[model samples]
Target: MIKIISMKEEHIPQIYEIEKSCFTIPWSKDAFEKELKENPLAYYIVAESKGNILGYAGMWKIADEGHITNIAVHPDFQHQGVGTLLMQGIIEEAQRNHFIGLTLEVRESNIKAQNLYKKFGFVNEGIRKGYYQDTGENAVIMWKYFKE
Candidate 1:
């Protein structure tokens, strides 16, 4: 059974591998370490089964909002509900922290990811031109507001 749990220092190497496999401009291991060890407002979780990490998600709690920084599932775990589980984990974490809303930016061309966000009640609010530095791709800003 895959379990969603809080990210730890030991999980960095595996999570970094997933990041590299999933994104063109992946974050370095040091960045993950800083987020886990130094960033007070950052929260991250991973999907693990049998000691192997299948996916991970992270966010930053800014004021009353939760800004999703990254969410990725390993290639072998893709389409197996890992992403959905990670999303649920992150949203639950946000709600537990009393966040008023959650926001994330999806690559404009990634309709699959956009649809996944939409399923979780995130709606397109605006666009950010050249949001992705790697490919100069536009981003579709999305937000999910919780009932007060």
Candidate 2:
């Protein structure tokens, strides 16, 4: 019984745990705090089941475009449709806001995530060399445009 809902302050600890579990360079709790409290452009959502958060995703809406900041699901929750639910929530949010498109960057080595984005209509558009300082990994830029 997973449900996608607006991310709130109480979800930070769980979201941070998922971030640490999923990424080599995880964002700090303070960063998430600022984004949730101080950033007007940022919109985030969490997937919860039986009172426990299983995943989270966030984006920053700039003008007519939405830029995905991050998306992660607990390893225990991976492959269980948590990611799909989170992505669906983000996409719906973008469309409701009348965004012309949505974009995100994935680690070049992360084929799974790339495929997930592709499944949601995001197409690889370019690359950012050494985008990840932790491993010097390149990033694959992807975009999904909405019909006008």
Give the whole-model CA lDDT for all candidates, comma-separated: 0.94, 0.94
How many pairs in model 1 have backbone atoms within 3 A of each other, for residues 3 or more apart or on separate chains, i.e. clashes? Answer: 0
TM-score attained by model 2: 0.98
Worst-scoring 10-residue span by lDDT in model 1:
90-99
lDDT per residue, candidate 2, 1-148, as tens digits? 8999999999998888889999988999999999999999999999998879999999999999999999999999898888999999999999999999999999999998998999999999999999999899999999999997
Top TM-score model: 2
Each candidate structure's count of clashing pairs: 0, 0
Taking the tens digit of each residue's C-alpha lDDT, what string does model 1 give over 1-148? Answer: 9999999999999998999988888899999999999999999999999999999999999999999999999999898899999999999988988899999999999988898899999999999999889899999999999996
- Give candidate 2 misplaced runs (Cα > 4 Å): none
Residue 42, model 1, lDDT: 95
Off by over 4 Å in 1: none
Query: Which residue pairs show collisions in model 1?
Result: none
